[model samples]
Target: MNQFIPCGLVPRLAVTVVLVLVAARCGGGGPTTPPPPIPTLTIACPTAEPVQSTDNNPRVVTFGTAVATGGVGPLTTTCSAASGAEFPVGTTTVTCTAVDARGVSALCTFPVVVRPPPRLTGTRFLAFGDSITWGVDSPPIPAAAPSFAYPEQLQQRLAARYRLQTPQVINVGEPGEQAQDGGIRRFRSVLLQHRPDIVILMEGTNDLLSLEVGIERGIEALRDMIREAKGQNVRVLLSTIIPQRMNGFRVPNRNPFAVLVPPFNDRVRALAASENVPLVDMFQVFAADMSLLGIDDVHPTVRGFQVMADTFFEAIRANFEQQVAAGVGGLP
Candidate 1:
């Protein structure tokens, strides 16, 4: 049966089968290639808008939302300024940026306007002391030229120098009241009534009159007063009792009843040092200027009151300096 088939035809058939097998092994198509990947977009907040507050109170603001185009994980936002890195009042701008899983990033801008906070007009002061502080002995005068009590003089000085507009000084001194008596009464009348920013204490003079009252008790009373003020975030200024040459010149001794002065001053100094309260050394000031004293020996003359007022002014100015250094500007 094969005698009719040609030999060349058999070879040709074999060659064709080989070529088809080779083509199949080679995948029978054009060159292999992969499809392009999808693009991802994202945003990052590099800076935040400035928040302005007119008042001294703190203010807080929020940043806008961040977005990412690709399937990325766990994004975070942050804020910063260009120069000082602190946010101040008025118009401020921040740069916003975005990143994707592919390490590609985008950038934009955020604009913010901050308004001022409400202003605090004035601060209150509370003066606690004895006869001199109460201005009890001063003669009556017209309202315009009211007898210049030390507290009144302090108020005037603060208004003029520190720019404390309409500052209020509440004198809570009671004549012949000792530290113990004043401490017991202050919580209700002076402390809670006005909630003063600062409390100036001119006490212990009457306490010294009693030879029986130990120095420790006076110290304790002073500490109590400080604790009370600290509870309400009020500052304190302690003044040393002025030296007395004689007890109203009525006593038999020509020598000073000044025995009480040294001990009382010592206790006050110790209390002030321990409690970290500001102190005005009226003793030193008055000792240098005896002319300020009146004939009564206990009370200070008009000139003496003026000197006391000057000492208080120095103390207040020192406080202002401390506040300014601590970054607290303006009145309390």
Candidate 2:
């Protein structure tokens, strides 16, 4: 079928159609252009509370999943301190970064605190004994010679291993202090003064030197000191007496008091075993190495002190590990 049209109407219709086509070709009469998509990034894992470090143990950081959407394909995600990596003690920033294929990145940071174990923070260790604990040997003098003593060195070692605040190691050793004096008179006062979390008892050397005091008396005094410290809720670490040098069936002239070492150390071992107190076997450490002793063969050299510190550190670390494993808090 054909429809008739006036010449004037056909010409107007054709002109209108041409105008519409021209407008469409010039892109002025089509749907509006779509806006660019918003880049999407979100942290799937919520912020987690700081976790405390276990005693003498390491802890690793764990992270949750992160998601990204609405960006270019092939998104990438990275995290600082990747999962299962050990974190140092204290607060650590675990950053999860989400990167889109368009090179756009969003960051999510959470605190992963590794709190120190109670043993490492605000804990005091008192080295209580005779001249040995006083740090008599090597360069520098007593009390001030902690740098050459086992206690201070142990503090440093522990700080390194645990990555926490170093504990205070107070040297309360007197040059000629006796164990009986410590057990009866000085124990309560010193403990009250320092309020130490632990006490390293290494007396009895002076007691044995007296000869008249006898090894049994020294042992009894040590036992008394241990009991007193334990009663006061202070952990005790008993150290065996170090060995002295002998020259051809004769005690060294400088160390005339060496006669009492063998029996005294034996009693010390027995006491520690019977009482179940932690023991640092210093006697065995120095027994084979005479060079570790000073010129007098009684006191230790600087190197010797370092070794002693290592031994004590190991024992203490082991004790802490055992306690933690057993789920026990404080002293056993």
Candidate 3:
């Protein structure tokens, strides 16, 4: 049978069908959703070896220039070792990871090789001096061992520089000992006992205070010591006595002993030149900076002792490196 429908009813049926389709589209669980794409993350470690200073201690390595590429969202590259971190001697594997805001990360590692400082030839050293050498009336110098004097400090410096060889630096410093007695009689005993390759001689500071041991006698004693060392075939390195600092408690820091420094140092200079001995001018070091001397006006402060070690090290190294390199007077 043919069914007859009105035009208004047909339009209403069409509108109802359209609404049902729209409801289906708005409903949950309509279609499977695709997973989010993986974020890009990659990092590059330092390729070239970074030039480091020639010091034996752990070095602070900087990698501010190491960059990461192809990362999504906010990206950051972090290292296991932070920048300015001290890396110890030898190879250290440093890992750098790049991460994005999406929690995606990629890492790269590099090897940093830190070699020990270069070595020197001579291993035996004898440091001969007076109370200043004994570290008298000064701030306690920092040291690993009980001895905080320059000879001990010098040993530490050498050990740090030359890890392969063992060095022995004997400190034979006598407190209140004058140059005439120590430099002549005791020096020969020490030289015979130690049989060192180098003798670091810094005396005559105490001699200036003695009325009997004037500059003339002091100079002769030093000359005798040099002659004694040469007779034994051991090298003698000389140093001028550092000037006594003025009393800071008193306005001028005026040391009554200060007036005598120049003439005495001049004589030492002349002696070194005449003897052709290697000289470390400690006088200039103190005169340039009086703070190196402590309040007692005779002994050096802790930092002064460090500078003392440094100067001695430089003098020894400069003088001996060539000879040792040529296999003249070298360590075993």
Candidate 4:
């Protein structure tokens, strides 16, 4: 409102107004500016209990909710899988990502393990292959019976370790049969007949040496056999064909196909990885000791069979024969 004012009073009022404005500008009057936000964005994933697989290999797994913390406003979070997701009988990883409006991102991962019900359920074992499985020790085509072969030895070893259960290894190794015509064709029938828990597959030596059957064909045939076994829920332990010295077939003629062993074994390794199966590198073992081979250069000596037994023993024990412990169950 307009009022009576002296010149001295007007100057003092202007000076007071100026001092207030100066105080406001010098951080002594109004609210102060806030510091920039510190970046502490974190994506936290919940610890989930492992789901046990049932009749199906893959089970439906439900996990706790994942969240993001300590980020700026308008933060967005995304997870790889929702709560109810189908997980296979192994480890499955779930990742969560949190992104702020400023494009700052934080990531975290947690594993969802789905365990199967005792991979080794039964004690029946099937040793399936060609002449090597038939056990043609020295020469004369076959040694009548595979009594002293790797299969028998493996059976003995398993029985020795597992005193409670009688581990029976049935030698179904047919001589001179190609993988396609012999292995893949009759694999399902054999599986049905034997009802084995594990199959020791060591075929394709005939295909390697045969002119009609190519080694690649043998590899495919082996793949088919592996799938057939898996379809029956039977575990498989694949083995590479043993090294063969030149001049096989008792003709003393140089075996031109002997050169194919290395490539064939390499393919076997890749096949093992692709199929996600356990592989026993018998080629590496036999190649190391040429003395272990028989006079015919194709079959293994008694010593070589013993070594094969030892190798297979370790594989079986490591994978299947674990004594039952807390969180680590094994066969009875």
The candidate that achieves the highest lDDT relative to the unseen native structure: 4
lDDT of 3 by residue, 79-122 (tens): 77766677665667778888888778889887665544556667
For candidate 2, give the lDDT of residue 245.
72
Q: Could you give candidate 2's per-residue lDDT for residues 217-298 as a string of tens digits?
A: 7788888878888888898889998887765233436345676687788889999999989888899899878788876667
* Backbone clashes, each candidate: 8, 0, 2, 0
Compared with the true structure, what per-residue lDDT tens digits does model 1 show for residues 1-332? 22333323344545666545555555665677887665555554434455545343434556655444543434333333342343434445666565544456666555544444422223578888888787653222212223577888877766655442456677777777888766556654578888888888878767765654745566678888888888888888888888776544544642434677777898888888999998888988878876666666666777777777788877776664333211212112
Q: What is the TM-score of candidate 2?
A: 0.59
Residues 185-266, candidate 4: write the lDDT tens digits.
8889999999999999998888876643577799899999999999999999999999888765567643666778878889
Worst 10 residues of 2 by lDDT: 323-332
The C-alpha local distance difference test score for the whole of candidate 1 amounts to 0.64
Give candidate 4's TM-score: 0.60
Assess every candidate by TM-score. 0.56, 0.59, 0.60, 0.60
Question: Of the pair 3 and 4, which is ahead by lDDT?
Answer: 4
Better of 2 and 4 by TM-score: 4
Q: What CA root-mean-square deviation does each model show from the true structure? A: 14.2, 12.9, 11.4, 12.2
lDDT of 3 at 112: 61
TM-score of model number 3: 0.60
Cα lDDT for residue 156, candidate 4: 89
What are the lDDT figures for the candidates, one per model?
A: 0.64, 0.71, 0.74, 0.79
| List of clashing residue pairs for candidate 3 | 246-253, 247-253
Model 1: pairs clashing at backbone N, Cα or C within 3 Å: 42-98, 43-98, 44-97, 44-98, 53-117, 54-116, 54-117, 55-117
Q: How far is candidate 3 from the true structure (C-alpha RMSD, Å)?
A: 11.4
